[model samples]
Each structure stands twice: as C-alpha cells, then as structure tokens.
Target: MFAASVAVLLGAWNNVVITRLPGYPQSYVPVNLAATGLLLAGARFAGTTWQELGLERRRARAGIGWGGVCAAVVAAGYAVALAVPAVRPLLADARLAGAGSGEIAHQALVRIPLGTVVWEEVAFRGVLLAALLRLLPPRTAVAVSAALFGIWHIRPTLSAARANTLADGGAGLFAVVLLGCAVTAAAGVLFAWLRLRSGSLLAPVLLHLATNSLGALAAAAAHRPG
Candidate 1:
C-alpha cells in the first residue's frame, strides 16, 4: 500500500505539472527502477526466489492470453457504453468540456512509457499482492488491492476536475467526479481480478497496456471534427 501510494502520488504530481511544464517529467524511468529495486530488495530480505513470487518463467501464451482477454473485456465494455446517453453526460460534464481535450490529455497521460507500466504492475500486483496474499486471505488481498487502486486514482482525478471547476465554476461538476470514480473503481476491481488469476504481474500489465493504447487510439480518432 505504501509503495502504491507513493507511485500514485508521483503520477498525480506528474499529471498536474506536465500541462504547464515545458518538458514532461521522466517519471517512468525512476518509478520503474524504484519498483524493481524495492521488489528485489524485499525478495532478498525475505530469503525467497523469484519463482516463489510466481514470477517463474511460464508459457508466454498464458500471460498474453489472460491479459488480452481482460483488456478486451474492459475496452469492449467502455466502447459499447458510448451510445448510452446518460454515460456521455456523466463522463464529460461541464468541467471536462468536449471529448476532444479529454482524449488528448488521456493519450498524453498513457504514453508514460511501457516500462513504467511493467514496474507498476510488478510492484502493485506482484510484490504487494504476494505480501498481502500471505498476510491475508486471497480474497482479502484482491479486495484490498482493488480498493487501493481506486483510492489512488481518486485524488489526482478529482483534484484535476475540481481545479477546473474552481477556475471556471461548472454547475454539477462534482456529480461527474462521482460518476467517473465509480467507473474507475469497477475497472480497478477487474484489473485486480486479472492479476490474481494470471498468477503473474504480466497479465495486468498487458491488460493495462491494451486498455491504455486503445483509449489513446480512440481518443485520437475522436479528436477530428466530424
């Protein structure tokens, strides 16, 4: 939880600054290094091998298949809901403006280097999940991880939306924040489940990559004026 919190905080800070700053913060490099170092350090201290963490080399297909399936589900779910009138309003609201800017910003955000994604999955789902699995029951570890994931996003996302509202008051923007959080929470849970089932962080990382890449692609496609 502590590591995840730090990662999220770093990401949030990076998100806030990237817009105004001339150069994007090279966050992924440091985050990946730190996460990998920390995990290895922990394993060394615990007198355990990589295989113990269930990170032993497995059939490549297992990772790809599991991750791909989960990613497909999440992406398909979001895409199918595009036609839902209620969903559109909740996602954009007055604060978010049209989908164009949102998509552009989202694409920029997800381009945080694939290495960072691997580190995050390893740290959050691999090392952390393994620790929690031993300390708590399987179900409890999954729930706690999911909950943490949700909480991690809340601060940055809500802060961004609220800042927009404060700069230019948007009526009922808080409702949009609430709705977005709920949707992300659902995603978090599903991602956690993928992590648990695949028995490797690779699954969640691939799923994340797929979702992010698709989102960015879709957002770019939507940026064009009809």
Candidate 2:
C-alpha cells in the first residue's frame, strides 16, 4: 500500500511537471532524474532486487531485438494511420508548427527517449510493477500498473489538445483525455509484457523510444508544408 501510494503521488507529480513546465522544458531532465532516483530508492526500501525490477543485463540483446520488431510494427501501424484520410488529421501535432526538421528530429530521437520514456518505463514497469507483484498476481500487477500509466497521461494529453486547439469545449476536452487514457493503457500493457518477457526494462524503453520518435517523425512529416 505504501508503495502504491508513493507511485500515485509520484505520477501526479509527473503530470504537473509535464503539463505545467512547458516554459522550462529543460527542467524536465532534472525532474525526471529525480523521479528515477526516488523510484530506485523506493525499490531498495521495499527489498526489491534490481533483477526483479528488470534491470538485468544478460538478456539485453534479445530485448533489443524484440524491441526493434515491436518498433517496426508500430511504425507500420502509424504509416497506415497516416495514409488513412480520416485518421491523418487526428495525429496532427501543433508543436510542429514553427519547429524545424532538426528540432523535430531532436525531439524524436533524443529528448523524448532519454528525457521522458526512460524515466516513465523505469517508474511504472520497473519499480511500480515490481512493487505490485509482491502483493498481486503478475497479470493483476500489470493491469494496475497500466491503469496508472494511462491515468498519468491525462494532464499531458489535455494540455496537448489545448495547445493544438483540438478541443473546443469541456466535453471535447474530456473526450480527448478519455481517449488518450484508454490508448495509453493499452500501450502500457504492451510495455509491461515486454518487461516481463525480456526480464529487462531495456526492451520497453527502446520500444517506447521508437514509438515516440517515429510517431513524432510521422507527425512532423504530415504537418510539413509542401
């Protein structure tokens, strides 16, 4: 219960940082690092081994291979989505409006992967999932962690919608948040599965990086003025 509470609080804190720190994007690095430290410290306090947290190095290569496969699948799916006229507009990102190709590349290839994905995967799949497993079945732990992961994206999704002017009213914003949560929860299950299957956090981290980076690239391409 203590671990769960801490995880919830930390998740809320993460939401605040993600939504409220737009003007200070650089602050995300240190804030995420601090969150990672707290999760590691909590794992130690709860007697969770590094191996149990999927921090082992032995299966890293296999994990990376699987991650690549997952990434390819995601990229293909995004391509299909982009090709579909109905779905294409939904993927539009306002952040790309004034962003150069270099900025988009950096966001996709570097900042998101290192600054956000690693910290999130470490916290949710690594530490929180480990904690939950001690008190619940494997599947239950995954579901719970995934649910929290979905909830954690609420603020960011809403914020993004507002930034993009995608939502017109409270109802629209609510719908956007709901859809974002559901999608993220589904993705979280995939991430949790990768963590369990590979017995290493590396797989999910790579898969996540691929998803974000490729998605960003696709969005940038779509929004680029022809």
Candidate 3:
C-alpha cells in the first residue's frame, strides 16, 4: 500500500507537469482533486485516520485563527510592496504578468486555492506527512516530506522561470532551477512546521492561499496599465 500510494502520487504529479494538461494555473483543479482522493483512499486503507491526516476538528479553530493572522500579514506585506517602488518587484513576478483582470481574478479566487492549495495541503502536510510519521520519527517525516515537496516544484519552477526569462544559457537555467527548488524546499519545511504546530491543515492552507493568491493579485496590479 505504501509503495502503491507513492507511485500513484508521483505518477499523477508527473503527468500534470508533462501534459501541462487542460491548461495551467487552473487546469490543476481536477488533477489535484483526483490525486488527493486517491492519496486519501490509499492512506485510509493503510490505517491512517482523518485526524492523523491533519484534519483534526478540535484544532480547526486554532488553526484558522493563526492562519487568518498570517494571511493578513501577507496581505499587508503585499500592500506595502505595491506602495513602494523598490520592493514592488518582489510582488510583480514577470511570469504572471500580462494577465487580463478577469484572468487575474480567476487565478486569485478559484485557481490558486482550489487548484493549488487544497490538494497540496492535504497531500504533503496531510497524507504524506502522516504516512511518514507512522514509519519514521516526526522530524524525519517532516524533513522527507518537505524535501519531496521541494522536488515537486522542479518542473513548474523550470517552466515559470523560463517564462519570465529569469536566466540565460543552460547553466544559468540550471542554477535558477536549483535556487528555485532550494527556496521551495525551505518553504516546505516552514509549511511543515506550521502543520505540526497547528495540528490542522487549515493553517498552512490559508497561508499558502494568501501567499499565492495575494501575490497573483499584486502582480496583476503591478502590471496594470497606468
């Protein structure tokens, strides 16, 4: 069951990257939802409970509260970035530029949370982390899951960085990919820590949503005609 679960997860993930299916930035909704369902099923079959999956109802309130605070902080940070000329580039990712207002709204409201956040929180912080904890120590589980989460971003990183023309030759692109992966891996560790601290996936989900969704909105604002 463990091996099957791993294979299924990896297969689904690879397919998403390889296919660039239906289309991206939004196409991932069904793909992630399906992968999430399969992972949950495999996890349950292997004796992992919903609470172990980081859906603990008792912790939900605390998680949501903490998450909301963090989300607000992120929003304020983005607001400041938008206000400042120097730091605005931090919010204005070139790869996400040129989007229409409707497209930006869809990305922030629908695609980001549903396509990106939901399944990711459930899969990494929820399923994989719980499964690993059953077999390994808690720290080791977090490390391994965080590492995998980082690796998961490699392809997407390559695609986005290329779109932004962030690097030049092959070696430069390789360097960019390495740097991107390293950053995401670090972020994964932080997200994992938040999951461990809150004991409910809501905390990380809201944080992730705010980070991506707000950034998308900020990028659109930055690129808007002035």
Per-candidate RMSD, Å: 5.7, 2.4, 2.3
The local distance difference test score of each candidate is 0.58, 0.83, 0.80
lDDT of 3: 0.80
| Candidate closest to the true structure, highest lDDT | 2
Report, for all candidates in order, the number of backbone clashes.
Answer: 0, 0, 0
lDDT of 2 by residue, 114-226 (tens): 67898888888888898888889999999999999998988878878898887788999899999989999999999999999988888898889878888888777677532
| Residue-wise C-alpha lDDT for candidate 1, range 1-226, written one tens digit per residue | 5445444543453345334444324454554566577766765576545643547677345767898887888688656645465553333333233546655564436433344465556656666666667668878776766665555555556775774563344546656656656766676667667766766666777777767665554444433332
TM-score sort, best first: 3, 2, 1
Clashes of 2: 0
Which sequence of candidate numbers ranks them by lDDT, best first? 2, 3, 1
What's model 2's overall lDDT?
Answer: 0.83
Name the better of 1 and 3 by TM-score: 3
Clashes of 3: 0
What TM-score does candidate 3 reach?
A: 0.90
Model 1, C-alpha of 224: deviation from truth (Å):
0.8
Local error of candidate 2 at 160, Å? 1.6
**How does residue 213 of candidate 1 score in lDDT?**
62
